[model samples]
Target chain A: MATYTRKNAWNQNGTFSNSDLLWYAKGVRAMQARALNDQASWWFFAAIHNEYLSGQTTFPGWAYISAPPAVPTSPLPSQSIRDKFWNQCQHQSWYFEPWHRGYLIAIEAQIRAIVIGLGGPNDWSLPYWNYFGPGNQYKIPPAFTQLTLPDGSPNPLFVKARYGPRNNGDIYIPLPPVSQDCQRNTIYTGSNAVTPNPGYGGPSTGFSNAGSVSGNLENNPHNMVHTYIGGSITSTDYGLMSDPGTAALDPIFYLHHCNIDRMWASWNAAGNANPTSTNWLKGPAATGGRKFVMPMPSSRAGWVYTPNDMKSLSQLNYVYDNLSTGITKQLVGSLAQRLTKLGVNLIQTQPQPDENMDMGGNSEMVGANEGALTLKNSGARTAVRFQKEAWAKVPKSLMNASVTKVPDHVYLQLENVKGKMDSNVLAVSVNHKLAGHVSLFGLRKASSNDGHHGGAGLTFILDITNLVDELHLNNALDADSLDVTISPDNDIPNDEEITVGRVSLHRQPQS
Target chain B: MTAAERSRRSVSLLIFVLSATCWGLLLVKPAAVKHCFVTGGELSRTSLEILLLTNPISPMLAGWGLMVLAMMLPKLIIPIQYTCERSFKNRRFRAASLFVLGYMGVWMVVGALMIGGILGLTLFMPGSYTPAIVVGIIAAIWQFSPVKQQCLNRGHNHKALAAFGRAADYDSVLFGFEHAVWCVGSNWVLMLFPVLLPGGNNFVMLAVTLLMLSEHMEAPRTPRWRINLSSKLIRILFAQTSIRLARS
Candidate 1:
């Protein structure tokens, strides 16, 4: 998913966007429906899986082989068995929704490949799990119980297999198969539903990884919440994430990231798009770092995510399509032309148009004011500094007061930069969400191993005590928060050079 | 041949001649060049002239273009020589890996010394002398040491040279890996320069590169040295492994 708000951040929904996340969720859900509608689809496949594990099947040529050529319908369910299955499922929380959404996508893709054979509309497309990549910390959920169906009854294995030897060892508990069929009309405990993590996206949304957050929930972006809860997991294996020990192995890891991507998408939408508004996320910090900040994929302090060799979503061979779509309405009007005509001698005269037709730079934020823009430093980032050739306004008194409780502290309305210009600095203030936070990124000259001085310097991160201390908030300040735009330091070159960079808030206070 | 005679002749005849020949080809006379100022510090002509005079070898640092040294010299020449004696010398694990051991032993001491020199230069130097003089002294002094011989990959002082006129694949690989380790160790001093600077721009890159270069040393050695070989090369080809594992 793209950035949720104008600011590059995870949505409160805790989502990430990728074609895989969408396609996989849809695929998995579709597969689930396929499996449940005709139990033969899933159960038959599950049987083959069981046999393969138990050394029974000599040549299990296919994932499934439905008996009675015609798909079975109105299947008879054993009362006791169905009741037990329903009973077990009734207890589960829906927090697994977006999470399972990814696995189902992958599983569906796999099934499509196996049954339909690797191409066409049913072509298999799986999540690109960072199996051997960096930032590998996957925790397997306890939901996937490895149980065998003995004469159609769920039988328990590994009774003493690892029973008392590890983790208080209670041999066997009644194993319940992972099912999504009984969920209709089921009031899900929104608390645990795998929705967008508040840390990443806004409320009531699933794990979106919008890169912003508004709705408050525990590990809303459930996948990353694993890292938040469990210490960490390495890239273990694929399609085998199980137990807390083997989560990284699960093929679902990529899907989890995809959902997190979605949460981020939602967050992009959640941000206050108004050019003069402020969404109080948190205020300045008390040294160390920002009161709050999100972990960036490739940041120096947190897991920094940069555009990889094939990092752009466009480059990915796989693309995810959403089961649902958000409204992307386009405006049809000529307001600017009308405004020009309305200045009929009654208003002030407009300035002569500049010669350059391409006034916009690629890096410019789209909103009237940059909405919750997220800037980060990687590789031992310690501080953030900002400097510029122009004057930057401070936050209003009310907004400043809001910072007292850390309602919001983000930069806004940054001047666009283009080409390789000389040291044009922007203001910088490190948000305290991690260590080595930057308070300012003084002006910098970008040169390719030679003299090609350019705009905006990015200084090494250091402690962010000063910016937080000089708290400037702008509530009622409208969409464009005034205090956030780094004021150009007039004392220095004072010639078009500006620098702006800030460290994310220091690790969200342990919680 | 007497060891001293063989070593000296090898150094003078092969290494020196080859080195001079290679260096001779790369010498480019500096002409009109772009002047870049660091920190808006006035770059005076006097400063440039003085710096040029002092830093004679600095020009060769980048445009040295002697990449063949990294390959042909270290990789090919040593393999042909080390092979002849590997079998008899190995006579099967009787002696604990002389080539890799000796090569690595020299590598460690040299690496440490180089590292120490770098630390001293960066931490201790008062910036009293010109870079040319400093580098010249460094280059001159290095010429006499075992480190220079190994790093340059010349066969002089190469103990197994006569014995293994055409060494096997195993000996070559061991020597090659050892050479890689030493190469890293040898460059430690020079690599440290970029990292120690206190700024963010290019200085940070230099620091990171230094870190990566340093970490890269951890490869091809240590626990990897602990791998066991199959039956065939145990006694013959050397650290051919299983023998090392058995000893361990």
Candidate 2:
């Protein structure tokens, strides 16, 4: 008996019908009615997000797993169990996709069981809110915004703490342009924790326990959505969705994550690879070899899963309604062209000798060693202008090639960053036009006491190829020298020292 | 052996000889000095006065220099090796020597300052354990500070050394100086503990050396409430042990 659950788009009118919404509301109501301490209760599910297990246990139904006697002396019997199982959300790592997939499955199973108990449909699957979907669908689903269901019962899905426009009125908050661009990232993974490869997933982080830098997908859209929803439009008060501890309490969080998970599926379908590293697949667990363990209802004996188990939806006995076929082909096809264009640009940029040059004549040799610049005490906006000689030395053939033919993907590489962790995002631009930005969300410098530099401060690579073309800098008529400006998204203190030991330009080869 | 291997062996040998010489001096030092260090015994007023009058610069510097060689040289092995690997094969010795000179120069200045401070304090404030005890407690507290961690982190930071010529020489010396500054910043308080103590006990010096090395070996600890608690507990335990020893 394959448990095939249909996950429809939240805002898809015909796909997620009125009856399905009613059943979901009823299931949520039933789950909420259960004692907070019960494993089946809504509170028990949310407690998993509140990492401080000992503190959360005060809200009934939250029980700790008893430690086996074989285990060494328990520090504080209760704390030991909480430490072992609680606080296990994998963020800022490659395992972000697979781990969350398993988590969603576990949560959905509990919801389905409740739905069935309430005399709802047997196949009551979770509805995904595809915020990145085609027009009008980006808005918050009406079912979630309504205070009451069709029967005049209080809607369990309604969360008052959400962003103003979505909660107060019908105005849907449009996704920021930064988030829209993240969807165009063709790469699935990066080499290290901070390689800024514009990958859908993050670099290889062992066990997904701790990471200094976040993957492009995790940093943008995923993180941005949380902050935007949680942050007030008028004031600085962060809503429940703002912090990871309280983010899950908002009903919309599940739907948002489901969409993200769907993106991963779509990314894979469009021809991208999940990390095959042993560290990622089994995870870097010392004792159990390599397995990701999640605490669930005792009867189910908790879900101990691996990345291998999450590769396909069939293994989990469920599939997204639009994951395989729909808009993915178009999205993937366009993305492939962009990636190919980048590859062509790399080839075009390579310095080649001119055929007109005399073979026997002494010609000035262009020095390969373009001098490196170190920027210290960089503020909110720091600009570096390339020396005229440096730009002049570039071979005429490399500069004369039509920018359209090349499919440009130029990158500004900021290497060996050392400083106190500043939360401000650095948005890179060429001349004055917008290029791309790197968020310093998780990559804060560890306080001196911890001695952890989070792998020696992250190396950010911001793609500025499009900016060059848009500014007409590739043309001979335009300025020969390039001006790269690093502008922080927020006002950063002028005194804060952010030492970029080396700054260089790189052309990423198309895979 | 290959030139590189031979150079590495020579560096190791130099460190070993210096350390052994320091240990030999400690073992064979005058009983008066030994008594002052081990038992926390104070010098008689007449002996102190005579010591202040006599030129003690040569002996004091030699002793301090040897102590630094024995205690700190082992810790420099990694940095020295890193420099050697980056340097041209033939110039490895020269690079290593210049690095050592730069590093030791910082310590020599610190050593001279300590001698001057100690001599002045002894001359003015005769027979006072108040300053020593206060300095010890402060040093202990400073161990867990963020500044200390920053210094340790800075000490761990190493840039790629240049392969040859003036660039190589400059990089080697600069790296040594940078490393020395951070190392001293991180460990100065701990180093000051034995110096400030009533007597220059070899045991106390060895204990401080071990503590410094242990902290260096451990991963940089972020300042967390739990870590602070544990550090406090360790301090309490150490105090308890000291009391027990005094009673015995």
Candidate 3:
């Protein structure tokens, strides 16, 4: 077997009309023509990730103006197939990285097989949309923007419903899709049962379709790209990528996930480690005695996978063309220089993957708002009053080196954030400075209340550790309350209100 | 210890003390608080009506309240811990106290109604093991019912409460009350079955409490009629034990 290399789509053949993209389009169209029940069909492959309401002409949270295509009907696939394979995307869990990696490989194999039968090259690999790369990469590739290909055939890559920032047919992400923000995280897993904010990869969960407390990587870039390309905050007609149920249907969804997969590889190359815990390594079975299985192209038995099986890219027989980008190299280089200055040899003092990576520790809730806040499209501010007793025990400076040997990390959480739309990117600021943006990706599924989170809705925890330290330096931390303003990135109508159940503050004093 | 950890320990301790006390009370006075509506404790319609009219409600309620505290409080540690941790440190005790009050208040009202219903059943229908058997069947049916699962799933939801002032107190009470309603919806039939039993009420209570705790530990799944033994915790323990044995 030949090792497949996934290259950046922007740099492929130095143009958009590369052989890889062309063959991918052809393969997708061919697959789309097959029956929905066929495992190798485009719809089946997408449904394996997630599926929309079976017979509903109108989807949830969608207005009458945006009627979805007729949902495919078929004689029921085997109960075993449905249970083992369909709708098994692992979101908001530690398995988010590994589950998707296996999923991509399975689908990639199917696509590659079809492409080969179509007389395409043998070495064809899935190209990723690295919007984080240099140049005008922020825009949708010109291939997806055009209504027709060079031969005047309808472009399978082009999706007309994509209502980007302008709410027009333009399907481009105005903001940077992903950031190095996720790379800073060291812990691979955290449990939502203990704390509101879990880990970098996600909280440990059992057979979660959409669990609570999404991992850091899954939250940003992954979600941000999905929501940004699918629709704007104000658009009523959201594209397929906007909703998780319909996200996998879009041709671009695979490319977006490919980039997310590449991010995991890059994070590893930077010396960050995955969890070695048996609970994580064993997949859902270790937690709930359930296995993570997907339908194989050739067999009815399907393929069973565990996080342990996915730890090695080389073992998987595929690798990204470039794992360590310039940005990653720069961050890793700076850290190396810092270690050298501290009289520690970088190579000799290399930390284990799990070392000092446990961010999901016991955090004390020091403050919270009195009630839920209805976020406005313009902006809304709320005050989180500090618990005077707990606040008294807090160090003068949050930065450990400045005040105490053990640094206390502070976090601001938006608990039970319920909204009907996925495009409501709330830019959260503390004391009039940008702290972080809360991406409403997968909001429709997550906020269903009937879903994994129950009626608690969605909770977002932002590590405002450095921001708090800056406040302390400016003597602003002495205040009885901290001002939190949540402003939407796009202008939304007054009717569509995003209700944040409560805005609370937590402090984790390192033990 | 952190306030949240302390609160959790405190709640666990409270459940322990309450359970011990209930068990002690049961051992000392097994016949002290018999539900006369039980299978063999039959009475005529006039006698039952007279007993209902003349009997002091306070003592009977006090007994039921004790039973509720012991059997139900174990399931509440998670909610109480969250309530305490979410509250301001100075107001933690007050918040948790109000939450208990709100929680117990709902159970007391529901318990009174249940007692009245059992008395009514004794008056109208001939009291036998049949009524107990029927209620048990209903409870079992409810255990697999979608509506009950929905209630159980909703029971896992913990609302974000206000940290200070009257609003905080109100929110704490509301949160507790909401949780108790769902708790009652899911398990009231099961609780009623033990009460209506001819005998072995204490033993049944213990069994039902354990069952409730096991189910509560499970993550919310799609509400359906399928069997949900909620052996997630048991699976975890089993996994841990096997791993340890292997390592050893």
**Index of the highest-lDDT prediction:** 3
Model 2, B69-91: lDDT tens digits are 77788668656865664444456
Clashes in each model (backbone N, CA, C under 3 Å)? 159, 13, 0
Q: lDDT of each model, Cα atoms only?
A: 0.25, 0.54, 0.71
Considering just the first chain, candidate 2 attains a TM-score of: 0.68
Best by DockQ: 3
Candidate 1 has an fnat equal to 0.00
Worst 10 residues of 3 chain A by lDDT: A397-406
Please list the residue runs of candidate 1 whose C-alpha ends up more than 4 Å from where it truly belongs after superposition: A1-223, A228-246, A251-470, A474-511, B1-248
Candidate 2 lDDT tens digits, A400-447: 443222222345655545544333446666667766655443333332
Q: Once model 2 is optimally superposed onto the true structure by TM-score, how far is the C-alpha of residue B227 displaced, in angstroms?
A: 8.5
Candidate 3 overall lDDT versus native? 0.71
- Write the residue-wise lDDT of candidate 1 on B1-86 in tens digits: 11212333343356436544543443323432111101111223334344434333333232222322311232222322323212
